[model samples]
Target: MSFDEDNSPFGAGVPSDVYQTSIREPVSLEVPEDVNPEAVQPNTSIENESPVNTPPNGPPLADWSSGISIIEAGKSTEGASRGYIAYTIKLGENTVRRRYSEFESLRSILSQIFPLLLIPPIPGKSFNLKLLATPPPNGVDTETKLVEQRKKMLQLFLKECLKMEQVRDTQVFHRFLDPNSNFNEDLRTGEITDLPLNPLCSNPFNGLDTYKNILYSYLPPEVHTTSMDLESLHLQQEDNTKQTSLYEYISLYTHIISSADLSFSHDFDKANKKVSTTARKLTDYYTQCGNSFNSFSLSEPGTELSLLLERIGTSYDQVYLIEEGFIEFIEKRFNDYWKFYLQCFGTIRDVLAFRELKGRQCEYIRSSLASKETAWQAFQKSDDESQRLTQAIRKSEGVASKHRLLLEPSLDVRFVPITVPNPPSKKKGAFSYSLSAFSKLKSTIADVITLQPELSREEQTAQLQTQINVLRQCLILAESDISKMDEFINEQFHLYHDEKLVFMRGLLREYCRHLVEVNEKCAEVWLETKAEIEGLGL
Candidate 1:
């Protein structure tokens, strides 16, 4: 499948085949031999559509206005020999089946395609690793619990993706939900491959843009520093008198979220697991107490006391059932929610890491330019010295030529080789010293000329200047990228914070509501028991 300039599978003005209204239902897991898969279509009639109810103080419901649901999950009949489960997704009247690996691919592609956006996490492959490693015997349905959990989490994943406009509008996303569309084929030849191998080195908004890719390529290779290393560096920078740039500040923020004292994932995991463990213990105690009361009541069979004890035992049973529901709620809502945010922490770190790399790229370019400039200056000094030496040698030659001309005109006046026989031994004088110095100077100039680079000094200077100019351009682009990234990350952080607050508010509200319900039912049970005891006149 080919993507257009806008990254849509269909070119501009071509309406997508995907239905505008999203509603889904699960069909039978077993595909019939005679049934045509292409014939199945989601109902798009307006009358059949139902309004969506959004919770108060929650995220905006626009993205989820068109609901996506996982109707059922079962082993694929076509792949029965290998035995992998497939989840049936329904949106409006449209339905499609996808495997866990497909969901993995989808998320991977989305992250690369939109690195700046927050991509939701899916249940890891480890969740069903056992089932995959050893498929059940034919017709056997083992690991139903794992499959059920995956279905719930995957459904949540789709809904979360729908909440983001950028994610929902993507052609790949729509194709994944299109029953007739070949999603795997599209994935193989998708626009994502056209992007730079490093997602950070591509346009955040449009990775396929060649011009943007070229500019981004100027960025330095990604730094492989660990979180601890980054944290240490950040602290060192903080200690300096110089103010931290936005990128450094973001790095520090992400480090704190992922690894520091303010780590949400770490704290949430600890708290959530503690709650689950405590609930399990409470349920176990209730079970034991209920059994004990029942056993004791049997000794007083047919007595009013026996009935009273039985009633009390029944209350314990009721409370146990309520607690069991509460446990399920915690697992589904709180535990899963924590896992989602944990994945988000990873994504946040990756984004900040990209920014860090870009910042480093800028630094690298500046350093390169500085070194080039220094080399150029040194070359200029040498060139100037060479010029002065050449001018001095020419002046000396001109004086020698003038003397030769005058001597040639007086050739007849002749001469003599008269030598002062007993001339005092010539003392080392200024004239001799000057002659020695001139000889040394001539050699120095010769060495300078001979030791010159293969390229002329002018050419060498031009080359260095060229390199400096390229580095300067790269620095400009790197800085621009960093600035854009900073703004985008900041905006996303705010959005994430808002969503987190809404999610936590809803979570706590539901938790309290469930607790109130359990208490109310328990109170009614005890009140009935009291009324019965009074009726017995005990």
Candidate 2:
């Protein structure tokens, strides 16, 4: 269950050389300088220290355990309608109701005393203005849910404090749990006592092999299994989808950039030159045919043939523009993957920190339990007299009662962690989809070109006539791809429904408009060519 440093999701830090190299050359996709790896990296020097089994044989564990509850359930008497988690804590025999402000005062004092300990996060006041305005359906009000969640979180915090040997045994900690005492007055007058300077207790996390080992020990078997499954799935998805797509995109971009200034092969250049000459010859022949024609039908085919040649010439010449578009895509699209990679890396760092903190807490709990048993046994032996022995037994009974209310042997709290949500993904930034579309387009064009031989005829004029018809069909089929533009956009991007719809419609409209112009010109040429050919009876 232990996770080694190599298993860290953030990977290694970008070398110092990368920054220097990027200044002189093209920038790479390595981790950005802003995400300083050292900031969140676990202190490796402290990872070898063992847990503290005995806490310097401290004074008898203080009777600080208490039964905590929420008092003044409804709205406050003050201006606010939503109520706070006003606590009613019973420390020893005294029970008193106190507000959140008092709990904060206790927390502040505890923090100063236990400087090395991972002081649990306190739940903030949970209130919503909207819930106050209108009641929610099915009696599941937002504000009520918020209050309950906060109460549970706060209860867990106090329980964790009691589980710490250093915290629970201290006079300050006892005053903190005591309901009758004014914690603020105690804080001003009471002195803070540090834990005994034992090697293990002084810096608990100073040497640990794996942060995950402690979490796995405390977590339920099912939760541990589920977490492992999720992690495996995450790694698989990242490798198969995110990283693979990024690699492909980078390769494609590099290929495009390297070949941008490269000329077409000599054969293709020669072929293009011949095609241009042939197109000019066709235009000249059409003009000559027009001059000899006596009827409109004969003249019309010649004019149409001339127009088709011009259209073919125009489409072929736009290859440079297409290449430029590819370059522009690379410049903008890489940013999406760059941002996502950072997010993924950051999540891993957070997981590491959380696991380490939980491990320390678990160690504290183990030490506290041992101390509690020892203190209880020592008291029993020291009070051999009937009067003192009877009082010790009574105090022991109270300790057992408070301990039962807090500790959950069946449910370890260390693994019950919280998480932050992922950031929104950009629509145009889906590089995989973009690359797929490019691949499809290239395949389609190649397939269409192969069909040219099927239209071959013995006579040069007949072959030219068939080639024109086939090219016209290709233009129409390609134009129809624009109709599916919206569907393509929807498939490619992770956008909100309304936003996806809007973007799809807008992009499709613009694309269709461009295609319509191309299609219209092709149609005009085809119609004229057909008319003239029919009139010539060829």
Candidate 3:
């Protein structure tokens, strides 16, 4: 979602403002790591669109019927193996190999690797990768044509095998939405291995409200999902009944982003073809435009501008990665759910195989939006605040030039503190440890601000003063919510990224300092209600 114009931050529009607004270090591209030929376009038409690498900001959420992961695949540079990822998915593990002879083993492997897929299995219709590798009467193998026909199928196979570990993350999101689950049995593995609902249970999509109304209409009615209308998605009111946990929401968004990055919904040779084509294009595009982002407007220099902003905005590999990731997430999520379902209720084989997105509709979307919206809103607000402060500096400077000298620039500002209705108050010495940690952080941040070069004593003082206040406010905020960290987990599926989790962790960590207790009252209610449904309905 775009930031508000009126409340703009960073003086992006405030011409006179000198400070960098959306300030962050320039992140280096993965470079040779993402060597694709299509990325190069010696000549390009003017088209300002969402880069292939950027997330597709689609429509609001709806039901599962309205909820298809906006399939924005076919992007990404063949960015090589991530060290962290490689370590996480060590090969030769039971979770990685796809044993075709044993369907259960195959399914297990698929579930671990691909957790968000919704492909209807073409029963009795199976083909092996090894089969495709063999030569045939046609010189190449018949498997070549087979993969070319259903290219995405092969891509899907690789996606599950090579990435998407949602099945491995099952008990997480499930526990998050199902409040009845307990998280006391902390797993030292730093993941949710034990499911409170069914220590063995699991479940999968993208929020499809993005296509304006055109795409939304294409979805069937059986699916249930909440809209992602920007206004509705924002966690504005603390006590509002519509309020959802932000952590869960971010996890969902992360899934969508990952979906685009790892899309491989194609068949063998075709999937390889797709990969090769993309790789060729990327290599060309980047090779042509070396170290010159501003040289061309948006699209690279030599191709017909794509009409769709989603497609035009990013490089080919970026979008491809996202789509591959999305497909992989589905495959992984589904198997996790199925396995968990089997563990939770042995007799409901029918339900495990047949359940749709009808039941978890509202909560899924709600939680996703809630989680992500927090950071988005905060970032938005913070940006706006930064701009306002910068603008104020400009205005005050003009006035001072006319008048005289001053040692410190005082910025007495007013902010409407966001409230979380009856926010769990910090307990006595609850944040002692965090407080100690924060004190050091405060000094560090202060020093960093003080050290920013080339400022007059007056300006440096002003910046230092501003940083002190910001640091102090952040610490206080940390104290208020640190204790709720662990409790939030075992609850959310971690739809967001590390930033979102850290935010929650920070809050909970602060709270834990004072030995504050997490309120499981809400969780208790959720479990009982779910039990009743499983017992009577099943």
Which one is best on lDDT?
A: 1
TM-score of each: 0.67, 0.24, 0.19
Q: Is candidate 1 or candidate 2 better by lDDT?
A: 1
What lDDT does the true structure give each of the candidates?
0.63, 0.40, 0.31
TM-score of candidate 1 to 2 decimals: 0.67
Error (Å) of candidate 1 at residue 495 is 2.0
Tell me model 2's lDDT, rounded to 2 decimals: 0.40
Question: Model 1: how far is 227 from its true place, Å?
Answer: 5.5
The sequence of per-residue lDDT tens digits that candidate 3 reaches over residues 1-538 is 1222111221121121111122223211111222222332121111212222211132211111122211221211223231111001111211111112222223322232222332122113334433443445664445544333233332233333222233222332222112233322211121322211110112211111122212122112222323222232323335443245543443354454344234323332345445446545654564344323323434544433322222222333343344344333333333233222222222111121222122222233334335444545565576689779999999999999767546565665675567878868776585897888999999999988778543544453444344333333322222221222222321333422343345444543543332222124324443654565455433
Single out the weakest 10-residue window by summed lDDT for candidate 2. Answer: 219-228
Minimal lDDT window, size 10, model 1: 41-50
Give model 3 RMSD, 1 decimal: 35.4
Which residue pairs collide, candidate 1? 22-92, 23-91, 23-92, 24-90, 24-91, 24-92, 42-93, 42-94, 43-93
Model 1: per-residue Cα lDDT over 1-538, one tens digit each: 3343332323331223111112223111112233322333221111212133332333333544467789998877565467677899976655789988889778766766676677877887764445644666752344766687788889888887888776655667766776776777775565544655555456655454533334455444343232333432232233352224443656655564656334444665577567679778988998999999999899999988898888888878987887789899887666666556556655665565555555554555666668777887888788889889989999999999999988885545478778878968868999999999999999999988888654665665665666555556656665655555556666677677677647766876886787678778768877887897788888
Distance from true location, Cα of 297 in model 2, Å: 80
The C-alpha stretches of model 3 lying farther than 4 A from their native spots are 1-98, 101-134, 138-242, 246-492, 499-538
Q: Which candidate would rank higher by lDDT, 2 or 3?
A: 2
